[model samples]
Target chain A: MSTVEAYARRTARRGWWRDGLEAAIYLVAAVGVAFFVASGGLLATAPVDHLYGLGRVAGIVAAVLVLSQITLISRAPYVERVVGHDRAAAVHMRLGKVAFVLMLVHVGLILAMSARYDGRSILAETTALWQLGWFIPAAQAGLGLFAIVVATSLVAIRSRWRYERWHAVHLLVYAAIALVVPHQFLEGSTFRSGGAAWWFWLALWALAVGSFVAFRIVRPLWLLGRHDLRVAAVETHPDGSTSVTMRGRGLDRLGARPGQFLLWRFLDRERWTQAHPWSLSRAPRPDALRITVKPSGDASAAVRGLEVGTRVLVEGPLGVFSEVARTASGCVLVASGIGITPVRAMLDEAHPACTVVWRVRSRAEAPLLDEVEALAAERGARLVILEGPRGPGWGTAAGETLAGIVPDVAARDVYVCGPVAWADAVERDARAAGVPAGAIHRERFGW
Target chain B: MRGSRAVLVAGGCAAIVGAGWAASPKELPTLDLVAPSSPAASATPGATPSPTPTVSATAGATGASSTYDGPVVTNARGDYQARITVADGQVTDVQAVVAGTPDAQSVQINAVAIPALRDEVLAAQTWDVAAVSGASFTSPAFTESLRGAFEEAGL
Candidate 1:
């Protein structure tokens, strides 16, 4: 690489890190300001019941923001480009975590303040939750769903087959967010005064919905209209997995890398409108882009019959997982099942010191195992294939299995993609082996 | 914003302030008319024959009468007499005797109301006249009693 290219690469990497740091700072500062405003006793002096009301409203906003994040991430065609999918996912996770904490505080404060006013025991008030009004229980349900999503995403539960199931379950959070709106508007006293409070709520709702419509609906449609791409070839591996090559007029200038996914909408009359996320199995080469898909769901099933000359819509160059440079002496790339797609893509451009640990149920299920092995051999990197049923024995029983094979695993930066359970288990195992949480990165699929 | 609601709010405020300023009770007239006879003369009407009896019986009277033989005035028009008591240059009490049948409930007035009114008037206190809630008319009557006493005392 030329000196300027090298400097530009380093600068871009630093910018991503800096963005994450700045987001964290802004979140903390906003929370601090909210705390000061709440604690200043101004609300207390106001005749209206203050803290309970504020808590209720904030809870509703938090819920809405959470849903908006999910919708934006799930449906945005250019999400990877706009926020870089991996960073966007991280931001979503962090914000979701913070929102959960705030919701807990909101509920606790509301209950406490309500108890103070009505001279009722906290236990009694909680038990009377159903009687408090329909909104209370609805909000509680939303909170419950939020907690489940966070808990399931933890490093422990994420490493199993259950992770895939949980992905579908987590989508209910959008429903939960929708449920809290009426509760906020009807029960809230702040909205009644109709000043800054009214405008603030209205603006937040508008911005959130506007972001959803812009990123998910408008941007995707615009991209589809501009780039009339068609599937040039469908290459199926021995393992029944497929890579659909899409060729378009301006594929060269698109400048996407391997490991990033695109929301591909095939022009098959039955499947034209449906959009699904698929990872780029190979580096973006001249003339076409390749997206590997495993026939897992309806979207994937449609790719089975995809023919040449079939027009398709591509909304991508997403995910920051590929761009995050491996600066360590040695790196570990853990892939389970179809999670190997991004890992394979990354492996193509990876430095020589990186190791590929491919864990699959059996040798038959190991798609692209030979290609990855060839790459590992060429790069002089260790490639360990654990062929067995998905269980504790497959590096999940203890951190020692992988750590035993590669003692330097503790020191290396680890990137994992797979079923939620496997990813989670790998993360747990890595952490147990003294890997720092920041160094152990993961991207959830199907959620 | 320039609607009926705004007009209503403005009207309500104006009404409250106006009512607060104007609701104070007015000064009552003093009962200073001279009695037809002195108490000593009334105690012994047999010693002197007055032109007429000082007390007259109404339909429901229980036959209680006292004679007053001092200066007397009688006419077809309604006769009015008032008795006054004074002490230390202040009118302490006044009792009016009119020919017409007086409402029994209106015959007695609380002494405190008269004294309170007297003090308020003397001090020129014009704000928030403290009248009894249910006995509003009695406040004016009490004021009149004070006036009569003040007149008798030549204030």
Candidate 2:
């Protein structure tokens, strides 16, 4: 039997998890609306009642989406394992925007209805709402914080700001969520009526916040105390890339895959507050793990100057661009520029039937070509190199289709990593060549 | 794939909402605007009469006239206690002694709703009047307390 069919069967069984988790997110939001209907929302006949009812539904959905957003970024192991970190973050971003708009709608409709009912202006109603409960004002303040966070997160704004500054501002989202929570249970009539609805919301919140505290914060601290990871060696390549190897005790228990990236925070006086995501350039060992950085930004540029003994705090073993995501026995790994970091590590762990396609501006410009070539030769994997610029296809020449290069590409999983446009082209070619969507994996360079 | 997922999500939400609607209280109790003592009146048993009245009616000169305070009824909004002054077996006056949530919205709602409810009960001479519109919480709470007061006054 061909290895392709065998591998297909293996991967087909695991595909349900991603779909199931995605469905669960929407289902949870639906349950929120269910709670509202159960609370007689449908029976609201008057104009004021209708406005209030719709506002309540909007509030419920917004709150649920915010919780989902929190869960996505919580770095929960199961979530990361299933959906991958990049996809999770993308969904988080999408939901955050929707949640924010719905929140504004909630506030608007609620204030409009209240003002109309009370025979008062919107401003007067705002004050009246403030007087409703102490949490109301706190919730308003939370909305302001959320606005600020969203503003700074805009593409134009984020591109200009340093990552550390943007991240510190981003942390305000947690506080926004915290401030918004009290008014939900204390003032919202659906939750205020102590019953199954209330308990359901309470449990949902506990799950989101609990996962965040446990996985994002507590787990990193535990790793620091337990593994005691620190920089053991730093290597600077001729291509202006730096490789830092960190040695830690019992790193096998860290559970990091060969190609996964970790958010690294170096505890140097200058770099402690900034954490950058860097992919492992080699397979993890029992005592050490290594990451290579090509300085594209301020934080990454400073990595070459790190001292050997610098303590590293990490939140990861994240993303699914690894063997665990493979669906076939034979695989094709495609990478460009510094994108080779994860692809190189992944190639080291690929099956003997694997193939490597590396695209670079020039051989000299390739960051880790030596190590990758050595690994490819050792593993007996096919190696293909394309060097040039301005290609009609993913490769350097026009009409260079993926199927033409690798004739059996349809039966194998194709992993593409590089700049966004380059990766998109590769993915498009892979799809056109008859590879299933599930069999085509693309690792975006940055979040 | 994104389109299919959205359809699934929308379908799932509709199903959940359908289930909630199925389980919801189907019939909102419409107020039976007729006095219990009137020959033409057939009171909705739960709306006008409490099975166990908590207060006793004091004696009056003309058949039965007395003041009765209903037992406090609590809901999500807040506490509600209705006081009734009965003279000669008729409900002379009704007042919501405690009626509203701590929120300004609920307070404002009750201010308008309570007076309308009082007029309804006095005109009907029973607690079986319809809930005032836009005051879903306060109206039900008011009627619940008024029902207890009616049973106490034996009217």
Candidate 3:
């Protein structure tokens, strides 16, 4: 192996192990913080009933922090470096799923406990206390929105349709996180009393705001200052999508891989100052990097209009969906809709030992199908197209369902992208067919 | 410094004006002729020949009446009934009798200021004597019922 490839392998291996350990440590810290805060005896000699109420509120706040910590840590700059991009991302996505579950429990317990004193149905009482009531529903809505994003980004969901579109929609997770803030402040009893509660809340707010600043603003600005990549070429596909090729002085030295995405902040007069994640469709070549962005959202739509020489800020080489990890003897690649962007990049590298399963609603909707098929043919990997609905008779033609078609699916590692639900379904199906949980990997395109 | 001096002069003038205001009685509706009845006058009966009970010597020294009096009657069963009467805002007589037991003394007030006192007590606006201890039920009820009758009699 080349020195670069060896370095990449070492980094990937260390990251895989460290990511699990870091996540575990963070989990313990989060739970410990919650338990300590909930043991309200340290504060005051309150009436037993009042103490119980106070303890319950403290527990809720702690739980929220635990979740917020998971989200924040998964996206932390240092943590990302240690875990590498894609492995860090996998941890981030799984933690986010767990956080949503915790958030649900926190909100439910809060409403139920609050109902005891208010002497009305939880809904009715909350409505009467308008400010407090808003938090419960808002938190619920935020969790629901997050769940939708996660569900759609699942492997099975991404294997079906436009991966780019689902990826763009998945950015709503940030908005969901933002929505949870007000509920924490308004309804949280801990916030009412100052001192420890005040500091705790302030710390949480700072962490959340700090993460946003780091991810959305600070990191982008830092990247812009250090690396100046200009648009080298803009290739428009027949499917109303365009790819912007960025070339810089030291693009290859940045050590980005195919299938790894970057937060592209274009510096055109019209589309400047907006950051969006785009998959690096082509592998890192010296002085040149290519990101194929489908004309889906505000940022991507402007990619086609960018001047050839316009400067752009690239914040990543983020995401763990790259082929830096162990290469299986046989692999099944699933792409739903626009989720094929990353898969296409992976296939471009030519892992001939892999089997590509491209799922789409209609043959016409598959934008990169020809290129994907051509790559598959060139690499000598088996290509299977599961067209239309796979109903009760779905598995008959393929001799089994998508899961069954790949009998070695359990043995082979799987990478999924697209809508959260698609990923979830695919992961669920894959696991059911005896796929080891660790082998079935996924990268969520969520903000 | 000038502002401070101005404030100090203004404060001095205000203090002088306050002193003058404090010195003046300022007109108030006179209740000098109608004085508060004395406890002693109310306790005695026919102590003076005047229709209004004589102001007690001690009351005059204190600038207020010392006693109050009304009426007293006896029932056929020898029960004592002290019917206290008042006229022209002064207690006139308090006739008392003991019919059977010394402990069971029945007191009544059919007097001028006494009726107002009774009205005030029964309305629970005030208690003339700190509510009678150990006889809370009987004492207040008896006093309150008599006060009601006194108010009806307009004396």
Candidate 4:
């Protein structure tokens, strides 16, 4: 069978399983709201009752989406493999925005509903929110923290601040969720003990938080134990980029593939806390891994100065940008600037007939050019270097179309990694050239 | 593919909600136990009445007016208990022994509801009466508890 058909067939099974889990997420939430309805939620005729119901549903949905965000970023292997870390984080980010909206509505409606019931004004009910049970304030704080996180996470705001700042604010999402739990049981209409809603909600929370702890925290710690990763060497490239090589025992057991990335935390006193997501710049061996990065960010900048044998930790081998995800027999690997890191790695792993397209402002700007050319020559593959400032889209200033650069582009799987807007343009050109959506892959790390 | 996945998710949610609606016992099954002379009105038999759990009835220590507390009736909302005071077969006062709600609607409704229902029970001197509007759950539970209190008073 052709590689495309075999890969497609394999992913078809995974697609079903992934879709099932996705459906379960929605179902759990729907059932939560539905339990309220079946238990006379729909019977609310009064304004106060109606508002309460609306607020409760909003609260439940927001809660579900919130937990879903946790699960998405938890680095669950199945989720990361099927959806890819980028896609999962993308959905996670979008869900955070929606959850925030739902939460605001929840707070407003509940306050209004309470005012209606208590025969007071909305302003009058504000004090009662704090005076009520601890969960009330907790829910309030959860909403506030989500708002602050969302505010700081906006692209405009996020770019102005450091990634660590954004991330630290983001961690409050977990604290927010923890605070809201008390009210959900004590005051949540559907969460009476031993009821179907109760069990469903309890189970849903258990799954969300449990998956988070297991995947995000426990799994990484376990990998740290099993693999014993350390910085083998750090090399600075001519283009002001650095490649950090790490030697580890039993790295093959980690199941990492080419084009995949890991969250690297160099356990140095200067920056042991910050983690950066960097893709392997070369194919992985059983004993070693490598990642090339531009020194644009603080942590990336520190890569060139790392001492030899420095301890390291990783939560990785994540992303589905691999040969196994290919939907066609022929392949085209494309990269620009720092984006070439993964494409270089994939060249070693690509089939002999594959093609490589590397874009750089100048020959000096492209990191690993010699290695890339050598790898392409060794593999008997086609290679193209578009050395010039990028034109509109993922093209060089010479004004070359994607199809003009790659032979029979429509019949091959095209993998491109670059700036998001540039990648989107490349995808646009690929689709325009009749490349099927299934055959086009893009690697993006920032969520 | 994204569209299909969304449809699948929505469909699954609908099916789950449909199942919950189906599985939900909207109405309480008929209880063979009779409504005793005490003023315990029926909370929705929907929650199964927690096996006839009774709240302690407090009696007036001294005074012509005697007081009695009612059985605790629980629903999806929470537990409820009512107290009724009578002077020589004449009900003078009725108060919710344990009827405050964590929710605003319940509290607002009960703020007016329990007292209004209490006045109705006192004027009528019977548990059977029209439940005040907007506080249906609390009214019924209050009536049932009032019945238990009346029985305790031996009226």
Best by lDDT: 2
State the DockQ, from 0 to 1, for candidate 3. 0.01
For all candidates in order, the CA lDDT equals 0.58, 0.80, 0.55, 0.76
TM-score order of candidates, top first: 4, 2, 1, 3
In order of DockQ, best first, we have 4, 2, 1, 3
Please list the residue runs of candidate 2 whose C-alpha ends up more than 4 Å from where it truly belongs after superposition. Answer: A1-6, A45-48, A157-161, A397-399, B1-12, B27-94, B97-155
Predicted structure with the largest DockQ when compared to the true one = 4
Model 4 lDDT per residue over A110-204, tens place: 88876655455788677655544567777777777767778888953547677787788877877877777878877675674357678877887
TM-score of chain A of 3: 0.63
lDDT of 1 by residue, A155-261 (tens): 43456544336556666766767766656655443342354545655665676667676766676667666666788898888888888888876665655676677
lDDT of 1 by residue, B93-125 (tens): 344433211211122222333345445544542
**lDDT (Cα, tens digit) per residue for candidate 2, span B1-155:** 36776788779878998888877655332322222322222222122323333443567565665667665665545556677888867888787656643343465557678889889999999898998865767788789888888877777
TM-score of chain A of each: 0.66, 0.95, 0.63, 0.96
Share of the reference A-B contacts seen in candidate 1: 0.00
Error of 3 at A136 (Å): 20
Judge candidate 4 at residue B138 and give its lDDT. 73
For residue B16, what is the lDDT in candidate 2? 92
For candidate 3 chain A, which ten residues in a row score worst on lDDT? Answer: A39-48
lDDT of 2 by residue, A161-241 (tens): 776677899989879988999999888877776788999999999999999999988999899988999999999999889
Cα distance off (Å), candidate 1, residue B1: 48
